[model samples]
Target chain A: MSSANSDTPTRILESTLALLEAPGGKLPTMSDIAKAAGVSRQAVYLHYPSRTDVLIAATRYQDQMLDMDTALAPSRTAANGRERLDAFVTAWCNHVPKIHGVARAIMALTSTDAEAKAAWDIRMTDLREGCAAAVAALARDGTLPDSMDQAKATDLLWALLSIRNWENLTQTCGWEQSRYAMTIRAMAVATLTQDTGPLTDALACPEPPA
Target chain B: MSSANSDTPTRILESTLALLEAPGGKLPTMSDIAKAAGVSRQAVYLHYPSRTDVLIAATRYQDQMLDMDTALAPSRTAANGRERLDAFVTAWCNHVPKIHGVARAIMALTSTDAEAKAAWDIRMTDLREGCAAAVAALARDGTLPDSMDQAKATDLLWALLSIRNWENLTQTCGWEQSRYAMTIRAMAVATLTQDTGPLTDALACPEPPA
Candidate 1:
């Protein structure tokens, strides 16, 4: 393939992100995106058959630019289930702010737009797999509570770490990013671990002095 | 005031709910809603100065139709903090499905419409107050964990019972309504209570026979 052809897709994806992240939260049309990318409508169509395909690809491209895999390395390589849980929470919570713009754009489209819903479902399913892996790690170490099986544990963890939950805490409740990460990690440990020691330790927030 | 004049607001609110809860999830314009109510566009504006006012009032009308105050009585009159927690969770979960249509409509508008965002915020703020009351009950009973203050516990519980979480569990994960309520109640008890006994009991999902 010509270098120009390869570069065209990159330009399109970058332009998609730029438009999505712009103020007002309005969804851009395909022609608008093509215009922004300095590409013809036909060229945009040649690269992506539909707007949905390009929008999903743009999110993936944003992830690549942000080095999402490297950010998740610690969780992937954790020594044990407990460490994995902590690392995963830290990594995911920290990552939420970075992806907030694109994530918000996609989420805004989800209710009325089928393709947007599909794109979102794909990403969430992937996130669920990550939750499952963390639960599996805990089960492997026998630290998972006997009350719930791995699947149930995974569901609880996944629901607990939802992007909406993060948005509610940080945006609605005005929690600082670091505090959200800490509190959520602590909540996860308290909720899923078999050991009471971590539960108490995790739940302990320092009191403000009079 | 004449009976006709007094009845216009009720008619307008009911028509707004009907349109919002209709199939297609398309936002209804003032004219569409006025047409549905057999009133002139001027009548709608007379009752509610703007679309936002009418939309907010429509949600409030829905709550009245569903007897929301009666539904919340159990939580309001709970014998203790733990009872309040269980009752509140039960009441809210049961109510979600009933209002899902209108809730989804308003949520869809929130990203692009500032007025819609304000309406959603008003309802969520009310919901958060319920969460705060439940947390306050726990603190009163000295059953709240020492690790977090009442505000923090309220934030956690409010996030836990988000409508989006309900959608994810039921619509996405295919959890039964009964199971979602039961499990979420258990999770609330497990996460915020000082007692570990309820934690184990709440987390226990009956194992299927091999």
Candidate 2:
């Protein structure tokens, strides 16, 4: 494909993100996106057959733009299960504030918009996989409590780390973002793990593995 | 007040709830509500000075219709701190699904609709008071951990018992309502209290005082 043709999709995705992140934004329609991208409406139609396809593509584009893989590498490559869990919390909590505008827009639209719901489901499914990995690692290392079922533990972790909880704590209760991050990890350990260490100890900064 | 005049407000409130609870529901505009209530648009205007007034009145009406005080009486009357905390969880969890449709509508509308935001805030403020009472009870009995500041503990419990968390656990994770209620109480105790009992033990049905 010509460079111009390749750039067309990038321009469209960039426009979508800008619109989503704009203050007091609402879901942008196809024409609004095409206008923002400075492309003929036909160009948007040619590249993505439907608005849902655009929403899904825009989300993935944002993920790539954010270099999410590198952001998650610490957790993904942790030497131990607990380290992995901590790394995951650090990475995920740090990512939430950065992406929250678009994330909130997508979530808010989900109730009435099937396309928005599908786009959000795709993103959430990816996050749920990471949560499952963290929980599974705990089970494999025998750090998961005997009293807790692995499946239930994973569900609890996922719910506990949700963006809504983060929003409530930081936005509603005015919690400092760093404090929210530290507190969630400590709470997760207390609620999900068999580890007997003091809850405060769980908040100790994780050292980068050599 | 004449019966017809008093019934006008009830009709409007009932119409608002029905409209809010409808599938794929959006917030009903003044005219839509008036139409649903079978009253002239002028009648709605006279009864509710503004859309926000109507929204706030409708939320309070729904609370009255649901008898939220009766629903919360167990927690208010619990015999002890732990029992109060457990009663709070039981009452809140059971109430969520029953009111979720309208609750979800109010939340969805909050972004663009300042009136909806205010209405939702009123409801949440009440919930926060309940959380504070639970945390205060724990402190009174010395069960609250030294590590858990009472203010932060109230915030954590309020966040933990949020409708979004309940929705994620039951809807996304497919946990049964009973299991969701039981597990949240257990998680709240583990995370907020100094209590070291096995989590499952927290789920043993709370016996109402004779």
Candidate 3:
């Protein structure tokens, strides 16, 4: 593809993000997005076969622009399971606030709009894989509690890192962003693994002198 | 007021719930509800001045129908903090599935409809109070960790009990209702209290031989 041709998809995705983050929380239709991108509706449809396709692509494009891979590298390359767990929590907790605008937009549409639901399910499926990888690291290191298998551990961790949980902590509870990340990291470590690391240790109540 | 006059509000609230739970997840306007209840729109308005008021009343009416007070009695009457925590988790987790339909409906409308948002906020505020009460019990019993304040602990517990989390666990992850309740209860006890009781103990990995 020529340079000019290549720029079209980029423009479309950027316009998609801008419209999604607009004040009203109204979902942008194909024609709306195409108009914002200065392209014809047919051009938008040519690149993305359907609205769900473009939405999913736009979200992925946003993540790329945000350097999600770089943010995830520490967790991906951690030396041990506990470190991996901590890194993952920190990365995800921090990332939630950044993607929150678009995430919330898509999430709000999931109930009534099938296309939006499709985009959301795709994103969540990817996130679940990350959770699975973290839990697998714990299992490989023998730090995961024996009673909790890898699947259940992943499920628990994924639930813990939900965007809604972050929204509740930071928005509804009025917690600082750093504190939300710290507290969630501590909670994840305490509940998911047998790591008596400093973070988890700090979360434990003192035993009365036995 | 005559008995017949008082029955109008009950009929309106019941019809509101029926419409909310109907297929296709379309939000019911006052006229739709009045039609369902076999009352004139003016009669519905006589009982509820706005759609928001009726939505709120309907949810509380559903709770009464479900005997929420009876479900909560065990938690309210628990002898100590630990027992209260466990009872509260069990009660709320079990209740989520029963109320999932209506909860999901209100939640979907929150981003777009101010009336729905008002209803959701009221329900969440009530839930936060339950979380606060549970955390206060832990603090009173001196089981809350030194590093975490009661407010923060309550926030964590409230986030954990979110209906979205329940939907993810039981619907997305396909966990059994019993497993979701048991796992969440154990997680709450393990992370929120210093209790080394059976549930928390079961969660810990065996320490390496010293």
Residue pairs with backbone overlap in model 1? none
Docking quality tier of model 3? acceptable
The CAPRI classification for model 2 reads as acceptable
lDDT, candidate 2, B57-176, per-residue tens = 877787877997898899989988889998998899999987887787788778777878887988899899999999999999988877677788888899999999988988888888
**Model 3: TM-score, first chain:** 0.79
What's the C-alpha lDDT at position A38 in model 3?
87
Cα lDDT tens digits for candidate 1, B1-210: 122353878988877787877766576889998997889999899979888778778887888889988999999999999999999989999999889878987888788778888889988998999999999999999988777789889998999999999988887787778778888888788778877665666777544322
Clashing pairs in 2: none
**Arrange candidates by TM-score, highest first: which order?**
1, 2, 3
lDDT of 1 at B172: 79
Candidate 3 residue runs with Cα over 4 Å from true position: A1-12, A22-57, A196-200, A204-210, B1-16, B19-54, B196-210
Cα deviation at B97, candidate 2, in Å, is 1.6
Q: Which residue window of length 10 is worst by lDDT in model 2 chain A?
A: A201-210
Candidate 2 — which residues are off by over 4 angstroms? A1-9, A22-56, A203-210, B1-9, B19-56, B203-210
lDDT of 3 by residue, A1-210 (tens): 122455898888888888887767576889998998889999999899987677778888888889988999999999989899889889999999888878987887787678888879888998899899999999999988767778888988999999999999888888788787877887788777765445436464322221
Question: What are the models' TM-scores?
Answer: 0.84, 0.83, 0.82
Per-candidate total of colliding backbone pairs: 0, 0, 0
For candidate 1, lDDT tens digit of each residue in A1-210?
112454888889888888887866477889988998888988999999888788888898888889977888999999999999999988999999878878987888787678888889988998899899999999999988778788878888888889999999988888888778888888888777877765656876544322
